[model samples]
Target: MPVKATREQRVGWHAAHKAACGCRDIPASLRPDVIKLLRSRRKP
Candidate 1:
């Protein structure tokens, strides 16, 4: 049987995705939009 990915592997994958997204620079004029969305969302 093929080996399955562990929980840590899954979490690390999502963490990498989030970090990649955070590195993207939001336009200064639109930063508030990003801030509002982040504030409204709960942590996973």
Candidate 2:
């Protein structure tokens, strides 16, 4: 991640990292946004 990454960028990188590595979880600070993103993807 960059020194000044935006929230969306951080979230995206974390999501991808989780899928590709599975070595760590998303940080607590970004959980809500991660949930929101997951929910939105499930919608039509």
Candidate 3:
């Protein structure tokens, strides 16, 4: 059985994935989550 990923790990993985794939024009499936993560980061 596989363990689930933590929120931080998921965010880190998503960021890394975007970095490797280029962030300028992400696929629709990944776009929402990526934007949500970025928005979270920007919040003070």
RMSD of each: 10.8, 2.5, 5.3
Q: What C-alpha lDDT does candidate 1 achieve relative to the native structure?
A: 0.51
Q: Candidate 2, after superposition: displacement of residue 4 in Å?
A: 0.9
- Estimate the TM-score of every prediction: 0.41, 0.66, 0.44
Give one digit per residue, the lDDT tens place, for model 2 in 1-44: 89999999988777767656869878999978876776665647
Worst lDDT run of 10 residues, candidate 2, spans 34-43
lDDT of each: 0.51, 0.78, 0.63
Candidate 3 has what TM-score?
Answer: 0.44
RMSD of 1: 10.8
Please tell me which predicted candidate would have the highest lDDT against the true structure: 2
Writing each residue's lDDT as its tens digit, candidate 1 over 15-34 gives: 44444676655556545554
Which run of 10 residues does model 3 get worst, by summed lDDT? 1-10
Task: Judge candidate 2 at residue 35 and give its lDDT.
Answer: 64
List runs of model 1 lying over 4 Å from the truth: 1-20
Misplaced by over 4 Å in model 2 are 35-44
Candidate 3's C-alpha lDDT?
A: 0.63
